[model samples]
Target: AQTVTQSQPEMSVQEAETVTLSCTYDTSESNYYLFWYKQPPSRQMILVIRQEAYKQQNATENRFSVNFQKAAKSFSLKISDSQLGDTAMYFCAFIDFGNEKLTFGTGTRLTIIP
Candidate 1:
């Protein structure tokens, strides 16, 4: 069984600053993929970043980056220079190679304070 945890239920960051959202997961599988998805009021899950279990390098996309600590089963998202548009409900998800379903964590509502 695989489970994802987001300890923080809510987070607030000042505009133009940086914020890191924590996420931890438990899994017995040796191979998998971790993802950070942001869903705003519209409820569309947007892929923020993803890391493959075999990849040594942390995945980064522009201002969104993930710190993938494989051994610890920790995957956290760091948003640099946070913007108002970044405010959303962030979810951590996991998926194995053959599975089409995503196991998601309790979302963390992030607010960008101006």
Candidate 2:
């Protein structure tokens, strides 16, 4: 069974600052997919970034980026120049080859202090 872990229960960052959320996972499969999803107060799940296990390079989207360590099974998210809108509950998830279901971590509640 593959499992994702977000060690931080909550994090706070001043507006316009940068924040990094930690995430780690345990998976036996050599090839798979990793994802970071954001759920705001509205509770809508939004894809932040994604990384394919085969790719050694991390993924980036605007202010969002990932540090993917396949050998260590660790994937973390970094938010640069954060804004108040960035406040949300961030979840790290994984998808197996055959299973479409996403296994998510407990989540890290990120609060951007304005």
Candidate 3:
């Protein structure tokens, strides 16, 4: 079983700035998928980005990116040019290969200060 941990429970950043939310995980499985999910005030969980444990390159999506350290089991999300629309609860998740079950962190609530 895998477990995700988001050390920061709350974070605030100025609009148009950059912010990074940290996340770490523990898993016995070697191959898996790591994900950063965003839940806006609207309460819809959206896929921000994903990283494959077997891949060396970090995964990125538009303004969102991840710094994945496989050996360290860290998968932190970096948001460049933060915006008000980015205000939300961010969750880190992990899925073992072929298991399809996702283990999620408690989440970090991010506020974009104008």
Candidate 4:
């Protein structure tokens, strides 16, 4: 069984600031994929970044980056230079190799304060 946890239910940060959304997961699988997804007011889920458990390198995309601690099963997302458009519900997700289903965290609602 696999489960993802997001400790912070809601958070707010000023525009242009940096914010980190915390996530922790547990899985028995030796190989898996960790991901951060963002859902805006439109309710469209967007992939922020992804990390392979076999890879030691953290994943990054533009202003979005992840701190992936494989051993600790911790995957946190850092959003730098936050923008109003960045306000959304962030989810932590996991999926083992060859698994078609994904387990998702409860999510953290992030707001960019003007």
lDDT (10s digit) by residue, model 2, range 1-114: 888999999999999999999999998888789999999999999999999999999999999999998888889999999999999999999997878889999999999999
User: How many Å off is the CA of 19 in candidate 1?
Assistant: 0.3
Model 1, position 89: C-alpha lDDT score: 100
Q: Give the alpha carbon lDDT tens digit for every residue of 1-114 in model 1.
A: 889999999999899999999999998888899999999999999998889999999999999999999999999999999999999999999998778879999989999999
As a TM-score, model 2 comes out at 0.97
Better of 2 and 3 by TM-score: 2
In order, the Cα lDDT scores of the candidates are 0.95, 0.94, 0.93, 0.95
Query: Which regions of candidate 1 fall more than 4 Å away from where they truly are?
Result: none
Count of backbone clashes, every candidate in sequence:
0, 0, 0, 0
Task: Report the CA-based lDDT of candidate 2 relative to the real structure.
Answer: 0.94
Model 1 global lDDT (CA atoms, 0 to 1): 0.95
Candidate 3's error at 72, in angstroms? 0.4
How many residue pairs of model 1 clash at the backbone?
Answer: 0
